[model samples]
Target: MDWTTVEKNWAAYTPRVLTRWPGLDEDEVLATDGDLDRFAEYLAIATSQSVQGARDEARGWAEGEEPADAKMDPTRDNERIFDSAKNIPVGEDVYSADADFGDDRIPEPPMDRKAG
Candidate 1:
């Protein structure tokens, strides 16, 4: 991820930048307009880091690996309401005929079950 890539995907990257540097004001960061040098300057001022240090940090971040989902266009997609749902293990039997779980409960063991 080069500066050009970051600049092209500024909207998607803004949230990440704000999250990583909470001391930075949104408006000030937005004002940089995806200029890496300008952003580094702002970061240095906000975090009290040396200008060179801030520049290196910002450069590293620009060149770092971002999660695939972070690059998604939020406006065109619906929120995954069930994203937090538990995942069942592969090849695991979900329903046991021997279990006596009632209709109101799932067949899975209790989440807080202790080891024998």
Candidate 2:
């Protein structure tokens, strides 16, 4: 993985780093400020691994990392206007006077009263 890329996008990767090494605190991780060597040092202390081992693990994590935007749920942005639209009645009830055939506009009220 490119350490430079990770450094350039540090804020996006911080959460993943914390997940990979929950023993480390957010303040401590943020303090590294995208320095690979400093991050490796923190990882080593938190995981009880050697600096080299921590570096290797960090590299592996970086390799597996995807952009945060790509991880968003597809359904999260969906706008459902009507939840009960899916439960339409069939057979005899299908031809009701109140059956809505996709026309959602509200009709204007009649101007029965005369202006003064």
The local distance difference test score of each candidate is: 0.73, 0.74
Q: Global lDDT for candidate 2?
A: 0.74
What TM-score goes with each of the models?
A: 0.56, 0.57
Model 1 backbone overlap count: 0
Query: Alpha carbon lDDT of residue 46, candidate 2?
Result: 89
Best candidate, lDDT: 2
Worst 10 residues of 1 by lDDT: 76-85
